[model samples]
Target chain A: MDAALTLLSFGPDGWGDDIATGVLVTVGLALATLPFGLVLGFFVALMKQSEEPSMRLAGNIYTTIFRGLPELLTLFLIFYGAQLGLQQITALFGEETTIEINAFAAGMVALGIMFSSYASEVFLAAFRVIPRGQYEGAYAVGLSHTRTMRLVILPQLIRVALPGLGNLWLILLKDTALVSVIGLSDILRQTGVAARVTKEPFLFFGLACLLYLVLAVLSSFVFSAIERWAAKSGGTR
Target chain B: MNAVAADLVERPPTPSRRWTGTRIAGTILVALWALAIAGLALYLVQSWNPELFDRYAGRYWSGLIVTLQLVFLSIILGAVLSIPIAWGRMTKRRIPSALAYAYVYFFRGTPLIAQTFLIYYGLGSFRPQLEAVGLWSFFRDAWNCALFAFTLNTAAYQAEILRGALESVGRGQWEGAASLGLSRLHTLRLIIVPQALIVALRPYGNEIILMIKGSAIVAIITVYDLMGETRRAYSRSFDFQTYLYAALIYLAIVETLRNVIEWIERRLTRHLKR
Candidate 1:
């Protein structure tokens, strides 16, 4: 009991810093992925919404392929496959390439790409909810497609997509732990290391779990705020 | 939520019929663009080594089997456990409901990898305490530990699915059964569970697919599931393309399961068909 307590203590001997740093890395990588995913998702959504047949097909294939692949496989592909592809590129350029893609970059690329696929679906469905009349009204006023999209469609799209996006963010936050497999010093990896060094798996892991719970609770409040904002904005519009 | 969904569903169809020759050409153009990406990927793999298939063929098959087994066992156990958990959550008493809610929150809040490690390594650390209770034998094995965590995690989600389905069952049905002098248990067993099963079936199928993908985490805990096998195979041969091939196998399983889920959903909702 004393040992378990000591392991969880906030002192230098404790695993607090290590585990906390892991949580930081996990959150950082997840946040980095968010914007990239949203952009990719926007394109996919636009492709999905396109009147052009070929654009829809391209979008469909993109979503289908990524959505169908397991998250782990996607991670491995981006991590190792990207590494190998880069090496070959450098070789062709006659440059000695030793610039390794670390676990963080790989995690971002993989999760960002995967998250975008799900986001596209959310955005697509959200767009579908807007009545055609709204789009027609924008067009009737001689609004250019780009201007109409900028002013009318994007705001409504964000409102409709906010709930689903909230869910996706929660999912991405939790899934950051998977990057630990590729050796990102994330919370799970840090906990594992601490567990191994201290030989007290329960104490460190239990702490890690608590930290994750706290993270979840904190973000849930953030999501609720976003939800309220979206709801209010939705009403005013 | 249901009201919004109902309104959306009741919305009349758009009178846009832009499907034309130009649209067909556009579709082909987009398809070709995607094919170009796929083609590039294929070219890279093929150029890297044409014999990559033969190099890791055997290992990929075995990995595929392990992934299927992992998915099947966890989901089956999860489905079985969901009933009691959902029942506990739905009960009138505060304790059971709170306990059920806590279970859901804890499992849902953490990552699957965290839960997997917590069970595999964390429980193993308690070998002595576990042995005192004669559960050490089970805890010693990675497979058992992985299954325990997966099942518990999935059960939490499944319980929520079941709870929603049960709540959505109309009060009219239960009252109607009561009018026939049926006991509560009888009414629930005959009417409630069957209806809930229909509503829960599709979500359950989605959970099963999620479980299939989730089982890959066990590879980190020293379970030789698909990912584990692929790592081993690649480490031995240094053939990276083989890993790509392994990914395709996972993709195949996902596609097949998706079709299976769709078919099951269609079958279950047959009554609503026009």
Candidate 2:
């Protein structure tokens, strides 16, 4: 027990700092992917709801392909495939530059794309729930399409979307761990390192689990609070 | 004219049909673009060394079989385990409910990869204790540990789904059963469970799809599942196509299951459609 504590300590002989850094990287990766995912998801949702059949088909295909593949495969594809594709493109430009993607960037893009596919479904469902009359109502009031979307549709879409998005955020948080496979020293990777170094796999892995649990519990509380707010506002509207 | 104006004022505007030459051209352009992308993908695949694929075909098949086995076994065991957890969650007893909640909370909140590592590595650290209990053999095997972790993790999700489905059953159903002098167990078995199963069908499908994708994580623990084989192939050949092939297989499995689930859902919910 004393040795375990010493190994986990922040002192010169310990791995506490490394583990903390890993936690930070995991959080950072999740945060960075969130907005990219939301924007792409919103775009896909619009395409899905578009009047044009071709646009709708494209959206459907995108979601189907992304949602059908495993997240690890997606990450591997982007990490390796993107680099090769980029290198080929550079060659076409007569440049000798080799474009390498770090695990962080690859993870963000892959996870963002994956998250967007699921998020699009959620957003599309939220958009569908609004009555057709809402659009007609906005046009009748002489609001332009952009203004109507910004002022009216966006607010309600978010309220309806809050629960699903909250769930996706949790899933995304957990998925950030997958980046460790590509050598991004995230919490899981750090735990593995610590475990191997100290020959105490149980201690480090258990610590990692406890840390993830804390993050999950804390984030869930925040989501519930936001959900309550959304519900309240939805009622008022 | 007055009558016509009043009619116009009362009626909703007709949805305008605005398909023009430009719209047709745009549609053609989109179709052509999609076709071009598909053709490029086909060309790339066709150009790859078929010999490599042929050589590794056996390995890939075995990996796929292992993946399917793991997913099926874990899902089945998880479903069985979830019933008790679901009951605990549904019951009025404080201790069981709290215990169930804690289990779900911890399992669901963390990454499956983390849980897999914990089971695969963490338990191995207790070899002496496990050996004394005659359980070292089980903990020492990567496959067993992977299966155990997956079963526990999926059980949490399945339990929540079951709890939700059970709660969604109307109280009237229970009252009606009681009025008929049916016992609680009989009511649950004959009426409530059947109804709940239908309600739970979609979520169950989602859980299975999720488990299928998540089963890939076991590869990290040195289990030669689909993803594991892909990694091995990639390292040997240094060809990125290995990952692509694996992705294709995964996509096929997910797509087929999705269609099957949708068909089942439609069949089961046929009564509500009318």
Candidate maximizing DockQ: 2
Residue A188 of model 1 has an lDDT of 86
lDDT of 1: 0.85
Measured against the true structure, the TM-scores of the candidates, in listed sequence, are 0.90, 0.93
Best by lDDT: 2
The RMSD of every model to the true structure, in order and in angstroms, is 6.8, 4.4
Q: TM-score for candidate 2, please give it.
A: 0.93
Alpha-carbon lDDT, every model: 0.85, 0.91
Q: Candidate 2's error at A88, in angstroms?
A: 1.6
Q: What ranges in model 2 sit over 4 Å off?
A: A94-99, A232-237, B1-40
Evaluated at residue A204, the lDDT of candidate 2 is: 97
Q: Candidate 2 at residue B189, lDDT? A: 98
Displacement of the residue B123 alpha carbon in candidate 1, Å:
1.3
Candidate 1 lDDT at A67 equals 86
Point out where model 1 deviates above 4 Å: B1-55
